[model samples]
Target: MVRGNIRGSAARGGIAACCGLAFLLFGYDQGVLGAVIGLDSFRKEFDDPNRNLEGIIAAIYDIGCFVGAIVAFLTADYFGRKGSITLGTWIMVVGTILQTASFEKIQMIISRIITGIGNGMNTAMLVIQSALIAFGHPLSTFMGLASRQAEPSSFGWRWPIAFQGVFIAAILMFLPFLPESPRWLVHKGRIEEATDVFARLAGKNSTINDPDVVRERDDIVASVEEEKKLGEATWSEVFTEGKNRNISRVLLGAGPYMMNQWSGINCLAYFLPITFERNIHLSVELSLILAGVLGIQYFALSWL
Candidate 1:
């Protein structure tokens, strides 16, 4: 059977576009709640949840994302990159529906977690998770503004949550025509299929035996064989120095992300509008506008 039709840079571009949409959905979900959380209608619907409850409602998605990451870790190889993303997209759709229809705080929280899980799975399988995040935030902010301008009812909040479906739909549409990760095929001992993927990714002029395809295919096979010889590293080995400074390497790799998270940027990202209103003493309207501007700033700077 045939795989993806596109080849070379075109195929890579298609795959990158799919990954970009996935992260865009992630950023939209991250910022959409903040856009509407401070609204009178939102507060009224949830009975004016206290700061504690509000925090839970806002932060619970991360917990779901963590679980989703673990889920991806356990299942991504078996499902393959494309499969993991497709599954995650469907899960996000389900979660988005639950969130949009939510009238109760509990349902909203649960839905947020579900959405996070899907995002987590996608992030685990793809790169550049944050590259397009700024775009998503501003898009959500615009949606929130438009929905509120149209009607200051529940639709204001619900529409922002549901707008995520558009991005999810793009992913579904593009995924089928995209090739799975060639390295993953090699890992599964599907050499011929992996070669085909390499050929498609290399260019239309390339075949399975094309020199470029052969070199890459052989490189992946060698790398996979070396990994097989080392065997899978256990959780404990991650902390131990059984072979090489695994612990140090892990810390070096993870430290930047940990510090970024710890720097409270997310707190700002997730609650920017609210912070502007409550802390900076700005009006809600001004706060939302400023948040949107900040989101634009983030999006622009991301290119650098």
Candidate 2:
């Protein structure tokens, strides 16, 4: 039993590590644009002769972010975390390639929007996955440690984003071995499959059949049977029922969290170089380096 627990812990730790890599990718996607915009090549390619065009070009990525957020909210629950994340990664890969190769201002704008979609999807998916995996686990400890490593300059902005592709590739390589969420399995009425998954996660030896596993399997069956006695609520029913008011309350309360995106810290972070140049009289190159360092510090502190 001790050996089984140890193996189970290790398996959970492996999943946590993979989840942390996903978070790193999330941070990189969010941080890279600021660094790129500060580069001379970006300015020379997009700034043209008009200041208004420059501002418009710069805001296009944020517009993409809005689009991505809406799409993620609408689809992540329906498609599952892994599916959304995989799709988001492909979008990111395409966006990055487009941005890297873009010579025209319009192309850059389009690429930024594409990248924003990926970024938003990644953010939502990562958060949901974290919460789900951490539900019965020691989430704070795992996430706190992972969060410490979220520094922006840990690999510098551009390299971090580029490195995300490698991490995503690594995830794909190992995904076949990963078990789907048991909750999802159970919800789909795959009781036996879900039981097998739970047993595997609990590290049951192939030769040893445990009564505890049977008990757990029976409990799941009983719970599902009980749930069926009370009809499942539709989306509208969930909102209309007083007993389910907590769900609506929580959703309504999340407005403040959404508002944080527009609270100016991110805006400042994204346009740090431009802000420094226009307000503090720093050159673009120096401003980006400073911004990168500061962003790293900000991310590092979040872990603490």
- lDDT winner among the candidates? 1
Which residues of candidate 1, in runs, are more than 4 Å off?
A: 1-4
The residue-by-residue lDDT of candidate 1 on 1-304, one tens digit each, is 3354888898989988998998888889999989888887788889999999988988999999999999998998899988998899899989999999999999999999999999999988888647698788877877777777645588878888888999999998898889888899999999999999999988889999889889999999999999999999789988997668999999999999999999999888889888999999998888888889989998888888
- Find the candidate with the highest TM-score and give its number: 1
Task: Report the alpha-carbon TM-score of model 2 versus the true structure.
Answer: 0.70
Q: TM-score per candidate, in order?
A: 0.96, 0.70
Minimal lDDT window, size 10, model 1: 143-152
List of clashing residue pairs for candidate 2: 152-296
Query: Could you give candidate 2's per-residue lDDT for residues 122-148 as a string of tens digits?
Result: 666554243322121112122222332
lDDT computed for candidate 2: 0.57
Error of 1 at 84 (Å): 0.8
Candidate 2 C-alpha error for residue 1, in Å: 27
Number of backbone clashes in candidate 2: 1
